[model samples]
Target chain A: MAEESAARKDDDIRILAFLCNWCSYAGADLAGVSRLQYPAKVLDVRVMCTGTISPYFVIKAFQEGMDGVLIAGCHIGDCHYLKGNYMTAKRFQVLRETLKFLGLEEGRLRLEWVSAAEGEKYAEVIRSFTEEIEKLGPSPLRKKKAEVGA
Target chain B: MSDLKSLIKEKLNDGADAFLCLKEEEGTLLPALITDADSPDLELAAVGEARYPLGKILIDLLREYPDKRFAVLVRGCDERALIELSKLEQVDLDRLVMVGVACTEEEARACGCPRPYPSEVALGEKVEAAPGRETIAEVESLSDAERLRWWKEEFSRCIKCYGCRNICPMCFCKDCALENPHLVEPGVIPPEFPSFHVIRALDMAGRCIDCGLCEEACPADIPLRSLYRRMQEIMEEKLGYRAGESAEEKSPLSFLGSEQDIKKLERE
Candidate 1:
């Protein structure tokens, strides 16, 4: 079984998630505490707010070989800073359109709103997003295996 | 061309502190700031074919001479840049007078400019709009993999020269993102694929005036203008906003708007 799991690791893909500390991060923690089973392919960075997530971060994540990127924050009108998520919505629209224009698959990037209480929702988001990314295989912009290892 | 010289002289005598225009020197046109009406350099003030980021220079000049009023020779793109810069608080529109010169038909066709004349024409006749959509359509027609390959091949030729940024008139940020080590790694030749170019394209989204100077300045012949023009089109399609086209309203992306605005965007 250990050998089989090790073999599976070679085909594993990486995803970078930017979660807001106010809502999405707490929601992710709830998922962990509730023992929810979600895909382990996602590695998350907790930001103070989703507004702090620059479009550059998304671009850099793709350029650095991540198969997918996810941005989650408070629901509209529920931001800790009152209006941070509004900027996120606006920036995400532009960034998504930009990535699409650049020929990247639309499924590679996503944005969601997960409240701190929605642990099940958080887990389900990860599972569905992971499944979608798996179907797309590796990113076209991913660095070669040798380059990543180096 | 002599008409521009007299207009400059007239403005200089009419309480305007100085005039900023191009003058032929050693058979090449260069920017000249004439302070005296009787200066011999006034005779050399000719609206040459070559274009410079005169608005960028005007920003510095206005800041340096805070109390002086200046007249500037402007083409369509220059006027648009100054209008946008004024919105950004980089230029004092009240302190500067614009002398608009319409581009010739041949010049307008060469630039692929949509609007080649300013609001008020001081010289030359207005030409028909020649929009450049061929490149944008070409990229759109290609498959995703083929499109990526095309851009990568074009970008790989980049020598990391920042000519595109330096020549941009609307670019006025003191601390440039292009130089940031975190965004663009230092000492990397060809600058990391899609990072450098896409960063620039994103930054130019609602800011670029589509002047075509960056493409002109590019030594590697990267289609910088086409990239930026598409960005402008995206802004127009998504937000119904175009840079340098308005005098009252700011770019929606530049502000923290109301909940109603968010709702409208979400529905779309």
Candidate 2:
């Protein structure tokens, strides 16, 4: 029983990450190849472009028990599809503010740019983001078993 | 003998196929779509506290009767709603006329609406609406933890009634994120905080005209207008776009941008 509760506490600190396929996904792959150790709490979803990551997906992540979310895209002017990252930039700005207004911690949602060659930076970001969410604890939206059954 | 009736009658005589206005019948104020100028409907045309999704209603009338031109009694917020609708091709502006009505001082204060008069005031004198920031101030006055606690408490009261979305003039989507089971989970009273309201706020970012109807419709009194108002401010600050301002200016979110736009946004 004690072991099960310890495992449950570890499971509570989940993060959902959306990585743009062209750059951030490659960077993450490079991090794995280089044996750069990062927290396993982040679960990644790869999309053609960061612009494709709608605010609904972010909201849904929190609703489904994600403690934090990270969106990584190509640097501006580096998008595989020209100008796709620009849309990502604008949407991310608005999404962060909207989430902030609703009382979500500012550190819970993050956006970063990682080139394919920047494997170390990708690992570093994941490490730091995991620590931040750890300090914040489980998401407020995280449903309890009693509440769900009720 | 209100100025609104004479204006409605004039429009009817001058080739308007129909006029849409509020009518007080047996102590109930309802939306009255009038065609005949002699039908005595103009006598009951009223301006009052009752707010309706008039722009949403006009979309049906205009599409159903494509050939007929109509006039609508519009308030400041209603005008903005209609203007945004026209941009989306939801309503044809060429076949419609606006008989604008300015809100009374008391009514404006009660609604906490800024700019209480339409561009062309066909009736009533324009009065200044009392500026409202009490809700924003109350939330801002708290620490992050307290603010979160306050929002959690406030959101717990939500019955998950879609009154805010239903009455909004700008919400014309056939597939709404708020209704999506994938986005907002089904069978939950007081929907998971920041999901339901956050989705609506994100959707309203570059679209909400700030009609204040959402706050009025919310049985929870969740200070929805303030949330959307902050969205509008962030939209302007980040993307330099304001919804319902111009028919020609597309929302910045509607399309991709150049490096210059992104650089300026970053600097801000």
Candidate 3:
């Protein structure tokens, strides 16, 4: 079991997480403050709004060798900008479908809504997401460009 | 094609300052912007078996000669491009008249045109062009793993040639997102899998008019039209919208959205 655990440690998976500043980002912060034990595999980038996360940003993450991507935004009717998350919903839907059509696994991209109060939920999400990426192995893009340059 | 010539003459008499269409010069078809009635260029005004970016040329003409009214030859896809261009404020549709030309059945089949003829076809017999989704079907049939491997191999052949964007009539932005180094890494060959192509496909969601020009221009022979058609399907399915279907209806992406859209998007 020690050797098996060591083998699991060798599995390299990089997950890029984009959290909205208003809700999801604060929730992640709350998780950190609460000492919620979750895997540290996620690289968090906070945006003012998920609506501003152009499909190209997600594409660039995948291209740069991210094994998976997580987009967590404000809940419906809870956008700090009133309707920013509405646009996020539409764009994300289209982007996800386009990615799927282009042959990326639908599981590789995920969208969720996390409130600032839901630190436990955010931790739970990251734990599950990290496990999922582990099962999927390293990204094909990562394998090709092993250095995964900036 | 004689009727086409007579129609051109009629339009010239009907107040159009210039007629822009394909003119054969020594058996080579090229776009000719004919302004003089007796210039003999009109003699070569034949709709030869070639497609040019007539919409792009029209945009230039409209910009240069703002006061002049011009008539242009438009295939079905060209018509859609102009309609979408007008919506984008790239072209003033009011000052231009469209001369519709229908693609022959053979050309239509080869090009996979859904509507092979323009709305008001003035040339050729209207042939029913069956839109083939063979590539879409094949790709859809693949398992998720197979699909990923297939696309990785296909996109690996890209030489980063901007022919797809250069020839696309709708891509008239002063600063194209594709060229933005931040969006698409400048020096990377194959431009990092999925990003280069995904950026384009997202932009094309409610905008691509199924011209097949991008595929024709593609050196790597990427099945761009099929990919775009799938984008169109998602747009229609999710928002009940298709690009260039009507003149006044705006793309859902353009607006913030109605309350219904927000609710629907939230649920989805």
Best-performing candidate as measured by lDDT: 1
Off by over 4 Å in 1: A1-10, A146-149
lDDT of each residue in A26-136, candidate 1, tens digit only: 999999999999999999999999999999999999998788999999999999999999999988888888887788888999999999999999999999999999998
Global lDDT of each model?
0.90, 0.86, 0.86
Query: Using DockQ as the measure, which candidate wins?
Result: 1
What tens-digit string does per-residue lDDT give for candidate 1 at B12-87? 8888899999999889999999999888898898899988989989999999999999999999999999988998
Error of 2 at B148 (Å): 1.3
TM-score of each: 0.96, 0.93, 0.92
Q: Write the per-residue lDDT of candidate 3 for residues B119-230, one digit (tens) a residue.
A: 9888888899789888888989998778878877877888989888899888888898888988877898977677788788888988999988999999998878888899
DockQ (C-alpha) of model 3? 0.61
- Pick the TM-score winner: 1
lDDT of 2 by residue, B36-84 (tens): 8787777887876687778888999999999999999899999988888
In model 3, which residue pairs have backbone atoms overlapping below 3 Å?
none
Comparing chain B with the reference, what is the TM-score for each candidate? 0.97, 0.94, 0.95
Give RMSD to native, each candidate. 2.7, 2.6, 3.7
Candidate 2 per-residue lDDT, tens place, A107-141, comes to 99999999899999999999999999999998877
